[model samples]
Target: MSADQWIAFAAAIVGGALRVGTPFLFVSLGECLTEKSGRINLGLEGVLVLSAMAAFGGAYWSGSAWVGVLAGALAGALLAALHGVLCSLPRVNDVATGIALMLLGTGLAFYLGKPLIQPQAPQLPSIALADWSSNAAVRAALQVNVLVPIGLMLALALWWGFARTRAGLLVRLAGDSADATRALGYSVAGIRIAATTAGGAIAGLGGASLTLFYPGSWNEGISSGQGLIAVALVIFARWSPLRCMGAALLFGGAGAVGPALQSIGIAWGYHLFNTVPYVLTLLILVLTCRPGKVAVGSPGELSSTRS
Candidate 1:
């Protein structure tokens, strides 16, 4: 890349981070919440796909983008709740339930969203500060949706909620030691169910962002496992919500690689760019997410091992 080309590449990466990170922000925040309560939902990918379809269908049916977003959130919450209920059953594996939900979510989205594929839905409004400016590059620099900031704020709020509030203490206590929680007269299953529901609603809204606002379309192939990668992001952020936002934007920027490269006419390398987030996810998981370190941040009841 030439000097100007490098500048453009850097610019593209910034824009890509803004546009692409929305989904990551939501999903990561959702996963962070679930993890805080000592539960994990692998079904987030499914929730993403389902939310995309629902958002599209809703916008098409309701004639309002905001309504579609709410519909999508509901879909995601319902799925997440189902997973929560299933996991609440004796001997049910959360990981397995998540995988099943993923398949179920994807399948339902494809089937029900068939009608939405053809409609030309109005693009939802975005907060474009630079777009109003006379300068083009400056405008281009800030094409990201307003939700990006909201996602960041949510992380900060969650971090505070987890570390400094009564509800946060309950969640932490439940996640850290279910036996102790039960002894204290709290229902572990109930808290996990609530956590899963909240996580699902938020993650679903993230999926809605993909179809209703950013690219602003309803399509089956919209999500690219931003949801799954979010699960890994939780580990990378070590369960800190603020760190999850930072990690999400990083992944979002990585996700912009293919398009960012192509924007400057470097099409040949575009294929390699698409793998950036997953590769980063793997690297972060390995380098930053030491299993031993996770214990401090993790809920007492959650365990990939030692359960």
Candidate 2:
């Protein structure tokens, strides 16, 4: 490739990374928080869809992007709370409940989002970092939005709190042994509930980002399984918040492959380029999901074990 061609490709990748990684950042963080509390919500995929629908509907009805974002977050938190309640019941499994929530989230999103299939919703504000650049290549490389930095900051906060704070220590303990946490007078269910709720909120924001920001619109078909893949990204990042950011961006870059290639006039045969993210997900899962590996980093009571 010529120098200009290389610059163009690099610029496209940067832009694509920002666009695609937004959802991943939120979902991965949610999953991280949830996992840290000894539960896993596989229904984040549902959360994404439902949040997208809610954000669009909220924006369409209220004419404010912020309202839509808030509505989406509430919806996601409610879903997560439901999962928390179900999983907390005696003999009820977290994984099973998460799967059910997945179904519920998807069904509700489809039912309500059906009406928003074509309506235009208000757009959320984003940074046009590219505007600061003089050269076209530089401009293309700098179109990242505020979410990128916010997500990064959140990751840093999570990492610091996880390693340093007493509250973080308790969360880690709750995951390692609910009985131990209970022995210390901590409410096991409460910890899990809080984690799941927080996770839902984050995931909801991710969903809102898809509709209110990136695509700046919504439909039943928006947010194509980014939530599910984010579950895998958690594993890829080894549960580290900073690593989660890296993984999110990596997945985003992979997701951008199809569009970036098409823009450069190279149509990947049969649209195979779109499969990059999934293919990467599968590869990461197979590589990391060894016997007993899940139990290693995973919380002690969480239901995402290999068995």
Return the top candidate by lDDT.
2
RMSD of 1: 2.2
TM-score of 2: 0.93
lDDT of 1 by residue, 1-307 (tens): 7776676677778878878988988988888888788788999999999988887788878888878888888999999999999998988888888899999999999998888888866456677655555646546756777567777788888888988998888888878888888999999899889988999999988988898777788777788778889998888777888888788778888888898778778799787879988899888777765656644566666664532
Clashes of each: 5, 0
Residue 179's C-alpha lDDT in candidate 2?
Answer: 79
Query: Where's the lowest-lDDT run of ten residues in candidate 2?
Result: 298-307
| lDDT (Cα, 0-100) at 177 in candidate 1 | 86
| Cα lDDT tens digits for candidate 2, 1-307 | 7766666777788888888899999899989999998888998998888988898899889999889989999999999988888888888877777888888998999897887888899888767766755668647555666566777888899899999999889888988888799999999889888889988988898898898877777776687889899999998988788899999989999888777776566775527878889999999888987776553466676644422
Where model 1 places Cα greater than 4 Å from the true spot, the runs are 1-7, 131-138, 288-296, 304-307
TM-score for each of the candidates:
0.92, 0.93
| Sliding window of 10 residues with minimal summed lDDT for model 1 | 298-307
Query: How large is the C-alpha RMSD of every model relative to the true structure?
Result: 2.2, 2.1
